[model samples]
Target chain A: MKGFLRQDGRKGIRNITAVVYLVECAHHVAREIVFPFRDQQVHLIGFPGCYPNSYAYRMVRQLCTHPNVGAALLVSLGCEGFNRAALLEEIRASGRPADAIVIQQEGGTRKTIAEGHRWIRAALEQLAATPTTEMGVSDLIIGTVCGGSDATSGITANPAVGRAFDRLIAEGAGAIFEETGELIGCEAIMAARAARPELAPELLACVDKAARYYTALGHGSFAPGNAEGGLTTQEEKSMGAYCKSGNSPIDGILKPGDVPDRGGLYLLDVVPDGEVRWGFPNISDVQEIGELIACGSHITLFTTGRGSVVGSAISPVIKICANPETYRRLSDDMDINAGKILEGEATLEEVGNEIYAKILAVAAGAQTASEALGHQECSIVYKSFEPTGPACMPA
Target chain B: MNTSSPQLLRLHEADNVLTVLSTLEPGDALHLGQTVLTVGKRLPIGHKVAARPIAAGEKICKYGVPIGSAVCAIAEGEHVHTHNIKSDYLPTFERENQHSYFQPTP
Candidate 1:
């Protein structure tokens, strides 16, 4: 498969002009920069932390150099702790154009905004003429996450996404599914799908780690809305959630920022390695979207039985509405309706094909509903990990 | 017609209860393996039903995991919700006047 070859030997499916905020204080300026250039492939995404942490730095660095990004403009308030120079250097080394506009050095808001606009215009022009390679399924890295689940999720959208994942893996696309906290009761089934038999134990251990971590936090990721949607127990929800992974063998386990070396089906272990520290692996759906982008997913298949209208900061999010009634209310925000399967109007394979087609179109530069509606939300929180346990990354 | 065949529902093999996919009124017959039981109450879609007789203090199993335990004795095919079942971990909260599985129809 051909792609826009980056200096780091990575391939990009889309050429995106990224506007980044250096600190929470500079987010307004970054949003302003993207407001004017929201057309085409210009996207606004950044961490909103005036006080910098190592996790934010690592995530921001990886996200800036992500293959989907072609050019980046950093908005800094000048006094923030973010290492602007290091970020810019990393993007430069990856062969992507990057520039940092310091608010203090530029004399204030008006001048800085003017300079930032001019810099973005010039950077977009330089990046506009870059050559792109012919791309195929092999060039794609796809991830899946389901939120706002209801009873229909397992019967419809989740399984349909699983079918699509199966086809993607068969076609040599890198596929990933995450949310360890949601895999509580289905560990044995998940372990059976591991690439190696010995890796099965590691799979169970990862889910156990998530359960223990959430238990320590005094609240499971499960919400009251889940019960209203007919999910009686955490295990019931886990069984339904596990359907999104399909029957493909799990290729490997990857941390939040770890990109897959080989394309197959990889389990993104969203739970941190040690004791409860970060509060939760994900505070909300968008944060998980950010993590998927950091892991190099160019597009995401988001299944929602309860109707979630969220899009990622970098990649396109294809919303697959699972419940027939929810689809009726949120049709404008959804890209595909797998709920038809539950209504007996369509088969899971048919809906899966529809989702797959939407993915290709979105990857080819078509805007997703969330993207067109300007929902570029991002979040990164502080977390401490004690390192992988003995059974985590098993031999 | 498929008498010998096992019931197919969302309930895992390890589960002691089965989920109701459609509403069932009292006296409706339900078959699980060789056991045939009549509904004690109307079970709403997406709610749980007792697959076997459950005594108070017995753990409630779904997807083979203990979500909570029964606070009252529940006969097989009886509707399982806040009225008869309760959570061991959290307070049992209910939506007042809202339709529960026991209420067969609106």
Candidate 2:
């Protein structure tokens, strides 16, 4: 595929113009502006909180300049706490078209939304004229996250995604698997799989922080559906969830907004450091997806046993159904029926290859089941992080 | 291995529990290799059943990893889930069992 080349030398599969509401007040205007342009790739994302959070600033900056995104429209409610100027400068520095609309100055909601439509259309036309460069599996970055996990997830979709990750890494592409809380008991095994021996301790310490954080919240990462699906403990779920990384050696660790400089298989550590002053590390699966995009993931593989129908704003989300029954119940939401492995209808390798092909297909502009169904779910939350440990980013 | 269509999925060879692929009723016979268990109770699909007699306080194994510890003796063919097994990580909160705020049902 000919990937859309960015000024930063990164390649992107999708050339999207992100219309981001700076705060909750401008969300309506942003949504209305993107409504008429069904033919163009315009996604709406926003930080809804009124508070000025450093985390939100970094997240919005990262999203605006993400490899998948070509340009960004900052919709400010005029007096919001977000640093709109910094974000605008970052977008402009990326050599991408950007426009800002302040609701107060632009004649309020009705007039502003009309003007935003013109700006987005002009940006879309400009992006369409942008040049694209040759891209392959090696030039792509992929991430996997398991949601609505049931018993079949570990044996089917997660392992299949892992297999895909293994193949992607072997081909010199970047692969990422996240949720440190979900990787509780597998630290030792994961550490042992680190590319270097020294990376082992850093791997262990990250999970330790996750364990402590979740313990303070009076919960493990395990959900009620997990228990019903026969997952007994957090560690047990970790063993299952860890398979999404395949058997590749860990390369480096990345906090929420850090893109991998050199990637093999990175653990996207979403857990906040220093103190757990923030509420939850991630509010939902969409937040995790958002972070993956912020870290420059081009395509995300979402494996679900209970069926998650979410597709992200910028990057494409390919849903893999892990349970046959759940697949039957929610086939419309699924892109790949990995549940076939459990039914003996398909092999794990077959599903893995299918996912790999699906990724390439999506990268080449094939709409996933979620995208085809118009499920543009995007989320971002505020959380502080004490910069990653030195070992977190391997040399 | 069962001569007929298999009813269970074993993730690991060392696992003491076999995940039921289909619901198994009492008196139904399930054969796995040389071992067999006459279902003592209804085992729902996707749920686990003890493959052998499990001692109290013994680790519950699935995917050849310790999922949790059993709180009571679980005979072969008994259901293995939250009822008897408990996680070694955070305690699975049972609101009704807490003395601080849990009120006894009248």
Candidate 3:
């Protein structure tokens, strides 16, 4: 199938209007810019920092220039240090249209709000009028994350997601599964499955980096309730979590917002890129979704054994239920019943197909369970990273 | 309840514990291989029950791997939780108090 070709030669699954806040100070202006559009594809995204840093700048630049985004309006406070010019240059380099408006320069709040709204409306009109071509499974990059997991997660939904991912990879789609802190114990096993045997060194280095990062931060990603739900160690949780990758050979590692160079299964190193600073890579469900969106995921498959109802601002989330009880209790929020495998109602293949079908439908413009319910839960945390240790990467 | 369908359940042959898809109450007849036994307590959905007697400090298995160790001797069909089991591996996070908090009642 064909796809909507962008100026940068990248194909996009969705044409979006992104209202960007240059700093925390400009959030209101950016949000107001998106308010008039009111289209689900028009989203609000920003960094809350007034002081500029490389990580923040890099993340903002990637997000603004994401293929899914057709155009962007950068809202800035005239006195902030966010470097709006550099960001606009990055977007312009991608050949995507981006406009930066400074609140202080545009007269004041009331006047800037009026000008920002007008600018976004004009951008949206041009964006909406852009012609779109048909897209194929191979052209899609999808990501998966499991939150509020339990024992049933490993037995059903997570593996069923794995199956769907395997099918996607077979169809040449790029798939990413992340959270190395959760995969602590399964590093060696995962390393063996890398597409490039040498890539195994990079794989272990990623997980080890996560372990060291979390250790330095005074917390492991593991929750106390994980033990109550029959999980004993971080490795046990890792084993269950790792199943979401299916059996596809891991291609390579990409930091948040870095697009995959090839189509296959890839591990997203969600841990921060610098020393142990900021906080965790993600503070909640939507932050990861935001990162995936920045990385150019057209959709996200979310597995939950304990039940999570959050969605993202830019992409649709298909929530796959991993536990029979959780499915029963939160059927309204679930798109696939993977728990049926354990209850003997359906096979893994059947559930996997159900999830894959849901992906197609979502891509075709059908609202997911989370989308229909309007659950736009988003968050981002801070973390500083030190480079990977030699043993952490694949051998 | 139909306890006759234990054969339908696939307990990882290498695992020391088995997960019950349905709830099991105390005194219910349970069939495990050639061994016939009665449930010792009511196990909730998604909870694990020891398939066989496990001695103190012995590794408790799940999914064919040692998830943790038994803190005390546990009878078959007993509910396995923090009180009866403790993780054998050190956690990745720093802890000020290094002692286990699990204590089995009887």
Candidate 4:
């Protein structure tokens, strides 16, 4: 397959020009700036918090310089705590065309919006000249997350995604599965799959941390819809969600912005480190998608039993519907009918191969159902985390 | 696909619960090994039913792993859910505006 090669030597399947709003005050201006280019690859992404956060800053920096991004326009409200200058400089240093427009300094909303349009016009021209290079399976980094889960999720879609992940790892690709809060009961089983023996305790510790964090908050990741869909408890739901990880040996643990150095299966720890200061680890599925994209995932496999129509701003999301009835009702929004496995129409391996093929097709420029339907959802919330320990990433 | 496919699926040999592959109503026959049992209640697709008698406080196994523990004695072929089982880890969050179609037993 072919990909857009960045100056940092990283390759991206998409070369999108991102219009970023640094604070909630600049969100309208950023949206207006990208409104005219809605049909194009220009996407709007931003952090709504006026309070500066290291996690948010690092996430924005990584996203702006993501391999999928060709150019970026930073719209700041001038007084917001986010460091606009540092972020702009970082993006520029990555050899990508980047500019920052502070609303307070640029007169007002109208003036800044006008300036953003002109900058985007020039950047789009520059991005059109980005060089393409040969991209192999080894160059791909894929992530998986299961949302709207039910009993069928474990039986069909999640395990099917696990199969696809296994195949991807064998072909030398980086695979990531997250939501440590949902993996409550599977810690021992998951830790046993760690690449190195030292990584096992670290894995166990992270899940324990997630459990403690949720316990303090009085809510696990379990949702009302999950219980209504027949899941009895958090651990029951966790076992279903854990099937998305497949059977690969855990290579490492990654924070939101930590990109994998080599091709292997990595677990993304979405829970905060110190305390549960932030409301929920991830308020919505979109937040997890954003975190995955920040870690440089080119494509995300989303398994849903009840149904989820969300797609991310940077990378394409392939929705795999696990419930046959739900699939029948929402077929237009689903890319793969993994529910066929439950209905005896298809086998797990067959559906897995189909998913693997769909990933390559999406990377080679095929729009997923979510993308075709214009589902470019983006969200970033305040979070905090300490760096991974030495044992977190074993060689 | 066959229209008369099996309505219930036993995921693991050690599992005490069987997943309903299709909505089962009272009197629907469930084939389990050498014997056939009748559904005792209206259970929706994706819900779980007890494959055998489960005593109170016993671990509820699914996928060959303990998902939770039964809170009360459950008879074979009876519906198994939050009303009868509780998480061994954290509490499951339930929204106040829960759907009224299925009410939890007090």
lDDT (Cα, tens digit) per residue for candidate 2, span A1-395: 88899887778998888999999999999999888874478889999988898878888888889888888899999999998998898899888888799999999999998899889878888888878999988888898899988777888899999989999999988898999999987888889988887788999999999999998876677667777776767877788899999988898999888888765999999998878776788878999998998888999999998788898888899999989989999998899999888778988899999999999999998999988988778887778887777887777
DockQ of each: 0.19, 0.50, 0.31, 0.73
Provide the overall lDDT of each model, using Cα atoms, as 2-decimal numbers.
Answer: 0.77, 0.85, 0.76, 0.91
Residue ranges of candidate 1 with Cα displaced over 4 Å: A1-3, A385-395, B1-45, B51-71, B76-78, B81-106
Q: Provide backbone clash counts, one per model.
A: 0, 1, 20, 0
True contacts kept of each: 0.12, 0.48, 0.33, 0.84
Worst 10 residues of 2 chain A by lDDT: A222-231
- For candidate 3, the lDDT comes to 0.76
What i-RMS does each candidate reach, in Å?
3.9, 2.2, 3.9, 0.9
In candidate 4 the C-alpha lDDT for residue A170 amounts to 95
Q: Candidate 1 lDDT, tens digit per residue, A179-212? A: 9888876787788777876678888888988888
C-alpha lDDT of candidate 4 relative to the true structure = 0.91
Stretches > 4 Å off in candidate 3: A1-3, A385-395, B1-11, B25-31, B34-42, B88-106
Off by over 4 Å in 4: B1-5, B96-106
Model 1: colliding residue pairs: none
Please give, as one word, the docking class of candidate 4. Answer: medium
What residue runs in model 2 are displaced by over 4 Å at the alpha carbon? Answer: B1-5, B25-27, B32-36, B93-106
Judging by lDDT, tell me the better candidate of 3 and 4: 4
lDDT of 1 at A371: 84
Tell me the deviation in Å of residue A169 in model 4.
0.3
Candidate 4: TM-score of chain A is: 0.99
